[model samples]
Target: MKTYDEKHIRNIVLLGAAKSGKTTLCETMLFEAGIISRRGTVEEGNTVSDYHDVEHERGSSVYATCLHTEWRDYKINIIDTPGLEDFIGEIISSIRVCDTALLLLNAQHGVEVGTEQIWDYVDKYQKPTILAVNQLDTEQANFSRTVEEARRVFGSAVTVMQYPVDQGPGFNSVIDLLKMTMYRFPENGGKPEKLPIPDSEKEQAERLHNELVEKAAENDDTLMEQYFEKGSLDEDEMRQGLKIGMLKHHVFPVFCLSALHNMGSGRLMGFIDNVAPAAIDMPAEQAEDGSPIPCDPSASPVLFVFKTLQEPHIGRLSFFKVLAGEIKAGVELYSEKGNTVERLNQLFITDGRNRHPAEVLRAGDIGCTLKLKNTLTNHTLLADKQSGKQVKPIGFPTPKVRVAIEATNKADDEKLSEVLAELHMEDPTLEIEYNRELKQVILHGQGDLHLALTKWRLLNIYKMHVEFLPAKIPYRETIRKHAAATYRHKKQSGGAGQFGEVFITIEPYYDGMPPYREHPVRETEEIALNWGGKLVFNNCIVGGAIEARFLPSILKGVMEKMQEGPLTGSYVRDIRVSVYDGKMHPVDSNDISFKIAGMMAFRDAFHQAAPQLLEPVFDIDITAADTMAGDVMSELQSRRSIITGMDSQNGYQVIKARTPQAELDKLYAALRNVTQGKAKIKAVFAEYAPVPPELQKKLSEEYKGAELVA
Candidate 1:
């Protein structure tokens, strides 16, 4: 392989819905570029991108695979991404580093739910995009309907660059609208001979070509003036105008493709090399301080890792893009993330699982290295430590599903944590947390399929047996009103005696509430609970009824009871405790005696204070196809969800509601079934609300108390 300058490198990410032929398109691109001797099909499980065992099992891409091709004078770096929205993490991470997104559309299905979901990210990032209508040879291919649907969803920016002359089983040619010619392919479809537009299609081709010319000229004043003067744009002028339009996100050129037949890939690659914005053409990457770091091979060296992978026997592979300067084999880089100085012993240009060793990679180029000690995804490595430069990392999406997982063999529990940690590093969306309050190891991910894939890898690849369990919700306990109770602790041992008495008034705590009026307050400590809300501890002791030194022990006892709530052994929050009076024996009243008396008094008052249980509530937004809107709504209502808003977006229904955290799992399953897996969902934490009386009673009864139950 050879190194390409920043301007000569073109990085593109293939994106679309499942079975939209993203992997096929990648393989076809490699074949067209002469990088591969033969093309591999997704059905044969030999495609470069979907090379993972899980992907082969599912017959789709589960992880984003990096591949490269050298065509003409440019080195095009390709990142083929998974199409399933469940693997959105791969798509997002790929999008974060790519210069352009080549989005494929299955010809039979015009605009799918997956396309709409991915469009949100592409639009958010404003990456230059080229939409390709693939599978033109399929029997049900409808190019016109697909174009109209794309225009409806993506607005007027969709400009057609080429159209299939005849779609369906016998499709063999496309009219190049921009070049004003026809490309007739041979039976096998590698290179096509350029021919003049036939008279039968001239009228329709001329009309579409005029639209393309105007769309291209609308981007720049110079091109618009030239179009107005000459009533047209030359081939070079049109390419320049379209490039500007693409960089501004004003135009998305559409092309016709049949990746399975190996048609239209060469044309698409030609357009990419000629017009698509390279990394240097797009906005420069920002440093930690929000300053742009331009791509320059001669500048100080810097690289940003966007993805990482762990090969079973072969250590780890970190894929990164050089943002400034160049990186060579055997170069040492400093990672500020963990302050580890890593040596890049080997540099390779990756093609699926295959790695081609390269001596050097210039700026704006994507490459991989092996055996980085501490660097992982989103970590930035620099050549100089005193440079004080750390590139900003990509913000990964939040997990939608939560489940408790443990090793099937109890002995592998510690090893399980270590493996999960490593998995989380490679894929940021897979989050793991050991919740002390619940005493469970929780795994959070995109959905059931996402978590199941993780489990499969843990079993097959890591040889660690694990099982998924139901995760528990973090419910809170609080009181509603004020109540007073007094308790005495007296323990008479053979050698010594312990005696103490405490009187405490417990009430619900809220912000901006006045101090206790039952007794003159001497001191107060407003402590915030670790779970949620606050705990107000008031010391109203006066006239030396209780020693000041003993007050600390009393507060400590109150905290222990709050940690394990008096109602259901959950964390108690938002409460006020005022210790007004207590009796302490001069000889026997020690810290232990006062602590026990204080805990018992708080518990006695809590029972009389009308305790309530609060459960987590989430603001959930669900996007489903139009036909499944009613069914989706009905399913939500069944879970006692309150519908907040409903609207339409790009031919889909957007439903917003507030639902209990306990119902999320069931709701997701129901939505998947009713919508046939076409719904997109996102959930965010909202304020906690009290559970129903029956549910509260059931939960309280189910909780097995440890010490203070009797």
Candidate 2:
């Protein structure tokens, strides 16, 4: 395979809202470059980029696909990413590795919710971007409105490089401001015919062209002086100025396209080839400690794995970008994460499902290798293990929804967990957690659709049938007021008798509370409970009332009760238990008898105490567009949420609230419906607050019924 230097390789990711023609654009690029003889439509499921079976089933892209095209003298590596927010992990990891983002804006609908969702990452990474307003051949296409909305959302850097001579169904001509010519396409739409601008459109064309010239010159002092002295910048000079503006994120050039009809794509690719910043042109990547790693092909090899997939016939394929130096098929590399050495037996440049064998890949080039054991997405492998230089990893968002998953067959339980772990390796957003307290295996993810797709993969790909269940909330049990109890355990058979008696007083535990005054606390131990809160066990028995040796057994029995509270099978926390007095028969008062006495006494006292249930609560911060803010706030109120604050940022409403965990399911579903899935929500653990009295009554009744069934 032929290898290109960093200057000749362009890594661009296609980002947009779903159905915004990204895959079509990729297919069109490949076709126009002669990489593919024919173009495939997304509806037919024949597009090379969206090759995953799941994507075909859903009729949309789910995974980020990598493809390449040799346009003119440059090999443009295209990473086609899914547009849905549920699959944001794929988009983010792709963004981290690519040098430029080719964002597509649907001409029919101005700036969409999904576009805003993706813009957050693009703006954060400061990647050089080129916006393509696509589907202009449609009747509802409004190119000017789309560009106007782009400027509003993304700021003044949105510079127009091309505008359609006519919009709507008859749109077939575009006036190129950079070249000062009009491109009139054939009826079928392939290469276009260049012609002089018609007098009807000449005036408006010159106005826009001058605006473009000023935008390009505004970025560089030298270019500005040249433009002011000569009244214009040449084509090459404009390219240089725009390249600088792109590198500094001060210019995001916009172009027009009908990717499906194969119009305007060639010009788009030409601009990308001549003006976009290559990896070599971009700033050096920074290490975790802020040290720069220049893109030097001769340096020691280092590659950061960005995405991986388990191809059914090909096993595991790991995709990465070489940060420095070159990698051969048989090269050996070491990962600092596990200090394990792995050999790259084979390497290939990928175009969706097909792979072409490659001898070597240089810096800034992306490729895939098969059968890597220790490397994973976001992991870096270095040729020199002792370099001790680690690249910063991609930051995946915190999981927003959680559900417990169980295997339909008990015997497949272990295999199910193993498969989920494998899937987690492929997609880091799918988190698996074995919540021991709830005795359920929980899957945490970005949304319901994400988890649903995970389940679909398990059943279809792995052939392991699994079902999702509502996760049980981890409620805590504690008391409100003080109460005392006494009980005697005695068992007399034919021989030895078990006999013991004890007294205990339990009150709600608070920090810095005075010790029990009825009797001295001889020995006290405060234990931090694993669930949460604390348990203070005090031995206040008078001298010789209960032997010191029997204290541990009593405490053990008390802990057992705390572990499984009497009111409900929940962990009890934040309560002080005082063992004031007890009687024991010398012969029958064994550890077993004292344990029974302590367990019975604690249960008796807990009945008298004002037991209450505490439910887990979460703090949620939501950012919604003005159009959906009222609906979002209304839905939040319906979920028993307490609004804490509201503010405005970037023309979006930011609302903060606290709500119980039990209401999270309702909140998630309601927010999606009310906001049309455009609002952003982040939830985190806040604290445990008392459950309402009526809800507490309902929970107790349900628990009792469950206990009866069990």
Candidate 3:
């Protein structure tokens, strides 16, 4: 409830796999700082961070939550993020706005697939990080083995700054390796007591301390010289050097803590204040124009909206990070994407769903405000109109599953579009689109639960009720070989007579045609028809057989036919129709006559040639425990996934495969079951491939059944 200066601020993000005690660690940190009188457990659904209704029901974090605490004259703004792959976007957004990431690992599980999954994001951002081996009070806790696992997974750069005094049953205290001091906790409650390292583990602690000292010495020439000359460096100099290495990500300090029991929390807090880097110390964000802007408190205003939420009472709330300069309430800012200017009615720092009014926001600080027009997630706000620059947004993973939504009430259909648009603006990862050919409103997200949750939020928060079912996959039908056909359109209405004849050859479009070679006539309006593998029309009517004036009408007709496939009523693609010969009456052969003739000729030729349907495929990445790898592989095989390769990482297995999108629409829960909730997978749309003969028969049967019902 108090404002602090930049130097006194420590922006930290809690990141790890699900059930890794991130929420518990956040509660522990807050309680220890005396910010809260007592700690709240996840099981009780009373934690300050995981406060969402859905999070409470599931007993896991579903969205990123922000909170601040004062510890030892420092303001630590902690952002706790979801650990499941479905909500990984929340984790990335949180990391982007923080100075350091506190990666939590379950002591019993050691390093998990989720830990390995998020490490890549941290590495990509080059953000400084500290490892906390949590759940140390659990029955199977092993501090030494977890440290070794971290080293093996994260390389030798991971060094232990503190070690637990005991394992599993006897876990009570930690020894600060850098300061050569042991801090033991009270059996009941209160501050830790200073004590000497036990004789049994003194030698092992000394060896680990030497390794940390050597790593610190490598950071500076003077420190290395001191170590070489006296075989040891001064404690103060070593601490300073270690901080430098850790901030640069050359060294990642590992600390042991039982966040549930409040053990080792004090020492963890000490390491954060003494080691974590400030926002100004890290690199500043750049604009889309590739110009690096300094994160000075007085620089030009540049803010990025990292998250958005649809609240029942507040309407829409947007959370943003000020990349440069100070932003005050009621200031006018320009949106680079919208090319429109808007003012901040009021500004606030957000904690969970709660918003606290703040007068101004400085660089490197994250905050939010009420309704702003033309501003959405991933949009950049600028101080003035002249800068005309925007900050590049972080990349969000693509949705893996799609579900079609239908309005519950017939009158709600029109309103559904507007509501879905607002919801999509709130969560960029939730994609909504109207597939014209399929006549369905498609909603896509990370998985079935993600899609279902989106629909739930739309109804609950936005007051739009809808029904969800499997989305219709847009399959393409095309001919395999060249075939020629002819058709004639004739109509007689009173005095006017309509007559037209079209003779065309249909062929498949070849891939990889040079851009210059395509549409040599209309260079400005050249389309990538070949790239989409769609139908193409070429007019080569010599001696004016069809007349140049009728070309447009004929092309229009061919497009109409492409929408209505020759066999299964699916959209047609990858074919070329050549209007080489045709006859038309100048007065009677209008657009309608040519259109009818073109459609008939194209369809006849398509059916004569070998027609086939194309289905969507996805590239999948699966990360699971070594014990579950075999079961996961078998499951993938059952889903018709073709394993491309396999590898082991930190005692876990990673399987890369490709499978039909339809087969993977509901695999999230099955994967969780097979891996015992230890597996995480990410999937993206690859390309459409031909359906196998047996499966094609099944799909054809379904297509026919859908037609009969229609």
Cα lDDT, model 2, residue 657: 97
How would you encode candidate 1's per-residue C-alpha lDDT over 1-710 as one tens digit per residue?
88789899999999999989999989999988888898888889888888889989999999999999988899999999988777898999899899999999999998787888899899989999999999999999999999999998888899999999999999999999989989988889989999999999999999999999999999999999999999999999999999999999999999999998889999899899999999989988999899888987899999999999999778899999999999889999999996899999999999988999999899999999998989999899999899879898888889888899999999999999999999998889999999999889999988899999999999999999998999998899999999999999999977679998999999999999986899999999999888989999999999998999999999999999998887678899999999999998988999999999999999999999999999999999998878889999999999979999998876778999999999998788789899878898888999889998999988887774434456
TM-scores for all candidates: the values are 0.97, 0.97, 0.90
Candidate lDDT scores, in order, read 0.92, 0.91, 0.80
Model 2 scores a TM of 0.97
Each model's Cα RMSD = 1.9, 1.6, 3.9
lDDT of 3 at 555: 79
Better of 2 and 3 by lDDT: 2
| Model 3, global lDDT | 0.80
For model 3, the run of ten residues with the poorest summed lDDT: 517-526
Q: After superposition, how far is residue 193 of candidate 2 from its true place, in Å?
A: 1.1
Q: Report the lDDT tens digits of candidate 3 across residue range 375-467.
A: 888898888779877887888877766788998898988888888898778767888888887889898787666776676677666677788
The lDDT of model 2 is 0.91
lDDT of 2 by residue, 281-356 (tens): 9889877878888889999998889998998867999999999999898999998875689899999999999899
Clashes by residue pair, model 3 = 533-574
